[model samples]
Target chain A: MNVSRRYFMILVPAAAVAWESVLAGTPEDSPNYKMQDHWWGMLIDTPKCIGCGNCVRACEAENDVPEGFFRTWVERYHVTDENMENPEVISPEGGKHGFPAAKEDEGKYFFVPKMCNHCADSPCTQVCPVGATFVSPDGVVLIDQSYCLGCAYCVQACPYGCRYINPEKHSAEKCTLCYHRITKGLTTACCENCPTGARQLVDLKNPKDPIHAFLKTHSVQVLKPQMATGAKAFYNELDGSVR
Target chain B: MAIFKDTGHLFRFAALFVVGTTSIFVLRAIVTPKSFGQYGHYRGAALKDLADRPVKYAGHQACEVCHTDIVTTKTAGKHAGVNCEACHGPLAKHADDPSNTPAKLDTAVLCVKCHAASAAKPKGFPQVQADDHSGGLACDTCHKPHDPAIAAGGAK
Candidate 1:
């Protein structure tokens, strides 16, 4: 059928908007992106992290995270002489830029990068009344923002304090483990931007991924093992004082 | 089949039950998404919703295609492993469109960002107190921004 220019012009703008919404709700094919073959996790060598805040800044830019809230941030653990088990932790401005200079030379200091643990046994997913927050087959805990009630149940349920209600979206949001990039076989924005290779995205199922060798040799600890949320974000050289 | 003696009232009650249950089934079919339980309790299509988002940083390889010379220089220097986006910021548009050149960088502010001294940083990560170190001079004045150790030994 032949179409007139007037109808064609009207259809073009409408189609563009409609197409994006359709794609957002539907499943699109990503070649070679197998869910069963991989289980996503992260590795952090805290000793190697320079506290440059590059990872934090990169995550915000890549994910378009709102200011005054973070999808990921760095905390400076100021271990003072007074207390060792409980270090004074501060994350100034979500540690988007480097932290302030240290005032005392008494005790040691270290930086810990924080994001969603993407736990296997996730409390956030369990408490979500709407089933909005859930664990993907690839083992990354994600939120279906479209289905989310914005009740902040997951935010309160999370032991790590990772989830937050996005001020703009008015939806509960946290790290998707950079799902958009990782599913395409690309490393996360934070891992890509880290200068010292301090943070690495690990695929637990991949036999040749080198994290297996490292895990075998190194002593790795997940935050708050006592809570037993089965958090997957692993930290090496984790101080006994860090919480 | 003939257990109930009051057949009229029982038939009406059975029909009401069937209609109520059928209506609920129809409502569920209408309200539910197509790919809701394809994987698990969550909507499986949410994975695609997530994966469909644009990859902002084009990765370091994207920079290597156009700027081979710069990549080579960086590879030879202390900044070898650092991503081009680490300093230049996300330039996915610039990489896609040749005409969309990124803005010029300021070595003054950029250099001190990572190099500034802090107790949390590694003890020997080539940090310096910016005020005492720079002496009101741009970092590039004495050191090459890419290959920092080239000009006058950027490190102590």
Candidate 2:
């Protein structure tokens, strides 16, 4: 009787603790997912993208992103033959409603999707005074809104113009590569919603990931190789005129 | 003895300062999230918050369950990898109740999203000068949305 009572006492508390953990909701619930085992990146096939703006809309809906601020955006670049270096770029409302029909057929026009590069040596992380912004084990650059100072140093430091101080949260916000989804073994909202398979989520550490083969075969380039931020977002068929 | 007597108040103040600092440290340690430092500098709790946010997208598989015929045809076509939500928009509501039918897509604007001609696209990609391709006719008028090759010979 005494032994049974002791077991019951211990087991009851243990069961309650287990239930509490379940209620708390774990983000990384995939049994096989290990953060260190993967390095997340993206391949943006510029040629494949049609500027449908599905990605932008999906991102806003998924993240509840506020108006006038964008975590990810699309830019329509019009490069004229006469001036290749100076391309006319516009992203009216961050291309959420697609783009206006081409006014002049003479220029070379294309859409470029932009987001956080998640740089290996990210300047944004370096400049953060409180270390609130950091690169996760899976190579995602994330910001802790609770700890962020809202100084905008990281905003200024980012060469890609991805970071913004979220108006509502008053914290430095940018693309997390959808860490929550990626960790849970799902693709990012933007990648999931892209009509064409233009934006692909790549796991660099995984040998089976298609990115390895794609990188080897394709002449891919980062947005600014000169900055040498070790930007993970690779663009395929990037035009020389695109800034 | 004389020096000790004179600095006795200083010793008491030093003791109080150490005790106060220690209490603050203990409180901070207790309040901080357990996994805060596990990844890097950012609070790991934020990840859980983000993951818990309600999913807005219904995903491709959910649509495939009900629309088996469409899925079958689409899988064999050029848009095999494209999710139904890409064009239909978020179908969480539709999936929950069939009564909430998704809106009919405008075929002309939908096709032009990818087929619009541009020098930026690779020469090999299937692009058409929007104005030149079928004039004012919708893309689906000539080509099937499910399977474009069905009407491959010419405009039907």
Best candidate, DockQ-wise? 1
Q: What is the C-alpha RMSD of each candidate to the true structure, in Å?
A: 9.9, 6.0
Can you tell me which runs of candidate 2 are displaced by over 4 Å?
Answer: A1-32, A81-83, A103-107, B1-5, B96-100, B116-142, B153-156
TM-score of chain A of 1: 0.86
lDDT tens string, model 1, B1-156?
A: 778687898889999999999999999999888788878887888889988899888888888898999887788898888888888888888888879988988888998788888777888788888789988688888777777885435542
Candidate 1, residues A103-150: lDDT per residue as tens digits?
Answer: 558789989998899999999999988778899999999999899989
Best by lDDT: 1
| Candidate 1, Cα interface RMSD | 1.3
Q: How accurate locally is residue B89 in candidate 2, as Cα lDDT from 0 to 100?
A: 75
Candidate closest to the true structure, highest TM-score: 1
Tens-place lDDT digits, model 2, residues A28-116: 65566777798989999998877878899988887778898899999988887775978889898998887776654677888899999
Residues forming the 10-long window of minimal summed lDDT in candidate 1 chain A: A23-32
Clashing pairs in 2: none
